[model samples]
Target: MNHPIGEQTVLITGAGRGLGAAIATAFAREGARVAINYRHSRNHAEALAASIGPQAAVYQADVSDAQAVQELVARVADELGPPTTLVHNALANFRFNGEARKHLDTLQWSDVAAQGEVAVGGLINALRALDEHFTTHQGGRVITVGTNLFHNPVVPYHDYTAAKAALMAMTRTAARELGPRGVTVNMVAGGLLRTTDASAATPEAVFDLIASQTPLGHVTTPEELADAVLFFASPWARAVTGQTLIVDGGLVCD
Candidate 1:
């Protein structure tokens, strides 16, 4: 199957800001029609769509909600045609301050379940919503944003890491099931992104420390990681699926 990035319609959840916004921009730059999905941050998402010109549009939806996701897909199809590529980047609200995080002893199952609802559950919703589109289009691409914490839990963001681990497993399983349909599912994991909304709480010193450990000598930026997402959606990655490409400057190798 030939899935060219330039000819695709890409739907990105939580694209109002941060990494999701960057991913939206990257696809728009590649000539694909972009649907920026946001549960909140309408201003940010709308502003982003404006910046991306007519090729991009904003849609509001809580990806973790099944009905909302169904409506989101229908609205995107009515407004921007069916999205041939899905980027599951929506995350439940979270902060990066390790000091503020609940320790293992204090962490509750609800905390983990909250993250899972958005990470794993959101993916499930997006896939189900796009199933028909993929069937009609003959092929599709699914990219789930993940974290390097799964590989090296240096900071031990227990809930976030656990949810992402489950997402990765689901990604692989979906890839296997979707392969015959010409739909490829994969993951793009990054470490300590230079500065996204979620990482705003992280101290500058931590960035410096992580950079020092990375072979590239710098923490990865959201834009840099977003490029890897384009690669997965591009025809170049037609034969690749069920894989996780870590974009943490060689900090963790899988």
Candidate 2:
């Protein structure tokens, strides 16, 4: 177990289901007090918190709303203590099925902007809300979830991939800006996960195909990717920042 992670409070955005839920579970398993942030998945969030026992609690906030995020921080601080580790995993409405995806010909800037609102814009909001707490505490961690499509362009998910790429840029930039305050900002980019809410619409054949092409001979799961995310928050990565760890079963060598 990492030194301080097991003793700190963690805030995981969009943790009602999917990849976010996996992250929350990972934190709790590490003995971190988990604050599960969800926008619309109340039932799922409550259920998850319950299953995690007393170490977890659920909060609702649209990460894109600055005011909401501020309020969220206050609530979590009151209930779970000010979060020393933040996982900005909130994603806009998206499905990972390539067949049902928008192609470059039919894609629109608005589609891309919507994702940016959540990916980049939401990150700004979360950071703004947590910056003071982070600097004051002097040892906070910011972990953003990203995608591996930037290198492979497997399905050409124009909007989703573009937004995540922008997120990676922001991740690095934030690392530089926040590093002096004794904080580390990093990203975990995972390939098409074997099963998550966002990837549920993907065709079975696509999963099978990806598995066959991977060096590990299997598709990555949300839990597997979540474990890599844990690494960035752990003491082992104390000297690391401004980087992306790709967890896709070696499908893309990035």
Candidate 3:
């Protein structure tokens, strides 16, 4: 029930850049073997794996694809001894541009469906793929990346927000079912990060506006949020499951 992070092999999705890379780095720093999964950021992922040393590896898989995830899980198991922690961070990584974001009228079910395929469906595929590994190993950990937009919809990231809402629900519900199976599921929610692939397109004024409103007086960095994710993977959080720990700069309280 208490797996020290140093002994865990963490598989992080969409880990080529941005917050996912930070999360991968944090786990590697803790001496955990890391499988950095990326859909498109191949170069970044490869560089990250090299920087993390031999304990880290690069994997290419679109989490929404069931077959790809299955192959991904199998490869990780063959290479890293069955992932003890699965970090479902393969987010839409939705851009934060207000003008480019989806509005109520402009948002379509396709947009929502696309996000859902990754947000919810990806988790399902990963869990299913990891089922045997967790069972044979006796237990495992599942840490999902979430956003704080559900509490405070500061911008109109309509479809993205909707998908995360459902993901959060699944996180808790999965915990209920998986807890009995010795699997712990939880979420780490962060607000608009200071710098990430997603936030790079955000206007400087918007960043400044958000920072001013935050209690921490600064935007949260990817590393900061990534560290919070490590908490859930570490032994300290063994008894905690189906919970959401918002790692923003206290921008929104849950």
Candidate 4:
């Protein structure tokens, strides 16, 4: 059976593990070559690339740095061909104590702005630098991992939520600007994931509460959210752009 995105190359940030790892694996399963991006988890990223076989490889760079990001994407293009698809899933946190909500004063505004700058800015650079290849190659796809927190602020982590809101806004406007050039942009926002290193600090009670609130009787898994990303990256979703797909197991109806 031929997968929808077969023979394509995908670049995913924060692919050392968790949702990023899931997204990379899903694309690999579809027979797309994958460039797994990581900051400090080089060993784990290499291991995953190996698991995905020869079509997968790892790239290391701190996406927050624009110069480094441009160099990173160029390296991927030289090695595996320009990525036809991109997934931005990297994040940096000041402090995430899931046991208790982070106090406003305790969290710095830069902590939040840094995320938007790194993740969203990095995406812009990748798209712009990779634009020529996409034009030459015909079309490209971009999917950004977002959070449901922006739509419903009930579980307020102001910094994280606010950054995602900004990311979403960027996605919509970028889609409009990039649409004419055969590039599409979209966002897949999920609720608290079931388990990931980033969420390791999350308290068990918080997890239980989220599970109880979801109509599906459980929180979404990283793989589940990855599936939504796959849709946007696949040819089946060629016309779908500037859209936000909420994959929270009905925890958030909006």
Which candidate gets the maximum lDDT versus the true structure? 1
Q: What lDDT score belongs to each candidate, Candidate 1 first?
A: 0.94, 0.91, 0.92, 0.83
* Model 3 CA lDDT for position 10: 89
Q: Which candidate achieves the best TM-score against the true structure?
A: 1
User: What's the ranking of the predictions by TM-score, best on top?
Assistant: 1, 3, 2, 4
Over 4 Å off in model 3, which ranges? none
State the lDDT of candidate 1 residue by residue for 78-165, as single tens digits: 9999889999999999999998998989999999999999999999999999999999999899999999999999999999999999
Cα lDDT of candidate 1 equals 0.94
* Model 3 Cα lDDT, one tens digit per residue, 85-134: 99999986567888788778777899999999999999999999999989
Worst 10 residues of 1 by lDDT: 1-10
Between candidates 2 and 4, the one scoring higher on lDDT is 2
How much does candidate 1 score in TM-score?
A: 0.99
Clashing pairs for predicted structure model 3, backbone only? none
- Cα-based lDDT at residue 235, candidate 3: 83
Question: Cα deviation of 3 in candidate 4 (Å)?
Answer: 9.6
Predicted structure 2: lDDT: 0.91
Q: Write the per-residue lDDT of candidate 4 for residues 169-232, one digit (tens) a residue.
A: 8899999988887788999999888788877778888789989989999989999999899889
Please identify which of the two predictions, 3 or 4, would achieve the higher lDDT against the true structure: 3
TM-score quality measure for candidate 3 = 0.98
